[model samples]
Target chain A: MGVNTSGAAAYWNLERYAERVAFVDEQGGICRYGQLQSQVDEFRDQLPQKRQLMVMVSRQTVPSLVAYLGLLQAGHPFLLLDEKTPAEQRADFIERFRPARLIDATGQTIESTLLDSGLDENPTALVEDLALLLPTSGSSGVAKWVMLSYDNLQSNAASICEYQAIVPEDRAITSLPMAYSYGLSVINTHLLAGASLALSSASMMERPFWEQLREQSVTHLAAVPFQYELMERLRFRQQDWPALRLLTQAGGRLSETLAKAYTRYACEQGKQFFLMYGQTEATARMAYLAAHREPEKVPAIGRAIPGGQILLADTEGELVTQAGQPGEIRYRGPNVMLGYARTAQDLVAPERPQELATGDLAVLDESGVYRVTGRLSRILKMQGRRIDLDDLQHTLAAEGWSLLVTGEDDRLLVCLTPGQNSEALLQSLAGHTGIHRAYCHVFERDAFPLTPNGKPDYAQLKRMQHESAA
Target chain B: MKAENQILNTLFTQSLGIPSDLVTEDLAYNSLPQWDSTAHLQLVMALENHFGITLETEDMLDMSSVAKARSILEKYGVEWV
Candidate 1:
């Protein structure tokens, strides 16, 4: 079955099911899809014509979801801004996007008067039109706005549902922020399947969160690698989640050891652990490793999901058909984003409009399973030797140390929590990589800097490295 | 010599990446610019390392400030001047 073809009509159809529990917020307030759709219609009736909408929402599930769908139905290309974003960053985003309308949940609303003036109430586009503009996480550098069409999102969600067997009866918990592609996809795919969603915005470390998961009988739990590591440290045994049928990890690579441990736990408890891989450019998930085959197949990101293809290409851009050879991972699918919006040019430039050359380097094993080696951007050239910081981190982790390695133009710094011998780790890294210990600086930090999404904040690490070097 | 004061001083300085001299007895944890949740975890880790003791889950949550950390450490036989 296809998603509703007409945007307004499809939203109205979803409104009929609003009482069935569409979303539960962090405060435990539940909002039905129908009620949310009504809110969207109301906002649409009040929105101005020929103007963009910028929404600033907390990681809260319900309001964010409502704002997202409402903007889409209104045919306005809305920007999703993280509520936790620093005030300076938020100001920069507003200046860059120059959105005429802003929907903020935290404080008094700005631009509400402009929207309430009723500039345009006519629906200009169908549900198949482009719905939202998202800023790429840009972990490597400056962020860019990505335009994702309705067809792009719908096709991706349908493909995800087909591959994961997501059905109407299945329930998923929103673990990540709605501003992120991964979290947003969870909401879309689950809603598309007409499934229930248990919205709990609290971090996994919060005590009440675990209780809510059990209380809600959440079957599917999706999280980033950091959260999984936290779970490992917390000793989140299989027995702790008797009602959880599936657990998914993505947003970054989960350490092989932790993946193995979680896999073992899942097997003993008769649960499935899915190791997924994807990017915001692809609208969330592109590949998933089935639960029963983890750790042993731990490093493998598995094959592509329905409607996606993973191909390996050499540095020369030649297709690397040989197995176990490293190459840049490329994806071709309907879900590939329309293109990035260039604020400077005031134009959307579609990169590889048909195929996305995901700058991630990976190897296709003999069994056709893909293992991401590292990002091309992550490669650091130090003393005439190219080094992947991720490789260095994995090597350190193998030696029983958790470290986050970040590189400046000329120097590389490794940060680790206290209790790990910094000198010993540096020596081990030098001994293993044949790089001299002088090239590495070790900092015994209390914890690695994390982004709002819980991933390591490499940019902040780089800044810290620069300051320390100075 | 309150153990809480000593523990608070060390934890506030180390976890928040501030100089020991900056962490006064009257300083509140949340009131500091750098003493966010991440710094709180660092302080906990540093205290755990310094005292050679693992804090209980409840204690970890309650030990939000330097003063509270000191009191929590006292329960583990860590005495301050």
Candidate 2:
């Protein structure tokens, strides 16, 4: 890998691997590495001469892929957002980040806008090394993004390739959104390893997705916890998909029952099931359970990757040395992000310290594997989307509602303060978050239970929820 | 409104949080912000519970639009009239 003068990594120079297959679209259309390089080169040539900040609504398509690679090759830092983001959130992003350009695509046609008031006229300064920006929270419409330098992407990709033993012959499918850090890492690692990818927006629930998976002979498949559950319900047969050599699960904790089932299935079928733990702040992955140890079936996140250290710290910020003691998972690695960009000005800010506080509580087992116990943050991951409860509360407050909100995965409990229109509140909450109304349980409470310190008693709320259900 | 149409309409509005007016035959999954992958499963479960039918995986995936959902329900012996 080579680093150019403008801080972009030259690893994308795919000329030598000319005849190699780089991409296979949903229709089984092939795009060789040579053609990919030419497309990227042509796309890059059309961009502005000077590097500019951009916002791209990334999709699972060959054109979107080319745009991303083209932007990176041109040394232009761009914020990658999911195409599913709401119109209001997109507007908020443009207003907050002040990106010079917006790149979006419909089907295979790339649409771009070079804002008349781009950075040139009202320039919000950006660090020279910032190569990418990814939202910490999924389509939650939060402005917070993890800032990554070219080094962060390169290092994480290398570590993933080393751990997974990725080879050029391996082929992966775009099962997850490319805007997601985990999905983006898959693309990065495969490209760096000279492997190939199949680009498709079709989800696993669809028959075409399975047909394509079998047709493409995809060797690698990565999914979140929700998708895994769906696979079980759909009675997905592992033996039928013989081409699947590597199966990775992340995004959130897979339920105990599903975890055991998948682990046993992998062991019996002689397939690899790598349970990985990661966050966007760390660029993508922090730890993974090894495939060789698949038979253990214990809920463990295994160990840190090469060149990374996963340490645990207690409430007082003291290191937890003894096994079985729970503490916050802290990681120190080159893959750690430069810092977060909350507003336009923060884009040019200096990098934070190298250490990353994962806000996840876990314990080290006797076997040296880390098993997550709980989350210290008020964040819920509903179908791979990270929703910060406190942030949602703030959004509600801004809309003139006072509500006590809490919930586990797939369920969000919102206690409406008395005298508020319950119907109006429910619709507002559902509409604002883009979460299904069915997932929310809107209850009315005259007074909420509070702790001695005056904080909302969430445990009491959970009890009330169960009681109401009964 | 017919009892079955009302039931279906209630399911769509309640599960998706969209108004009844938006629950047209052309209204499709993934076309609305509220009816994403997360909402899709919840809608599936709601329809099953309300209609007292178990949808096969293929039918669940193929039930993309409101019209398609109605046809799938019809296949499972639900009357549209």
State which candidate has the highest TM-score.
2
User: What TM-score do all the candidates reach, one by one?
Assistant: 0.75, 0.92
Q: Please give the fraction of native interface contacts (Cα pairs under 8 Å between A and B) kept by each candidate.
A: 0.00, 0.48
Local distance difference test, per candidate? 0.67, 0.81
Model 1 over residues A1-470: C-alpha lDDT tens digits?
12334443232246656667666655666666677667666655655556344445546555556666666655566667666555666666666655556777532236744333122332232123446767664222235767777667788888877776877667788777777787887777788777778877666655566667778778888877656754654556734776788888777667687778778887888888888888777877778888565456775789898989989999999999998889998898888887786452233334437888877789888777888877677755433234667766776686788889887434578888888777678657654443444456777667788999999999888777668668
Write out the backbone clash pairs for model 2: none
Looking at model 1 chain A, which ten-residue stretch has the lowest summed lDDT? A117-126
The pairs that clash in candidate 1 are: A7-A127, A18-A34, B1-B81, B3-B80, B4-B70
Worst lDDT 10-window in candidate 2 chain A: A1-10
Give the CA lDDT, 0 to 100, for residue A403 in model 1.
84
After TM-score superposition, the amount by which residue A102's alpha carbon in candidate 1 deviates from its true location, in angstroms, is: 1.2
Task: Tell how far residue A47 is off in model 1, in angstroms.
Answer: 2.3
Question: Model 2's CAPRI class?
Answer: medium
lDDT at residue A283 of model 2 (Cα atoms): 88
RMSD of 1: 9.9
Error of 1 at A95 (Å): 1.9
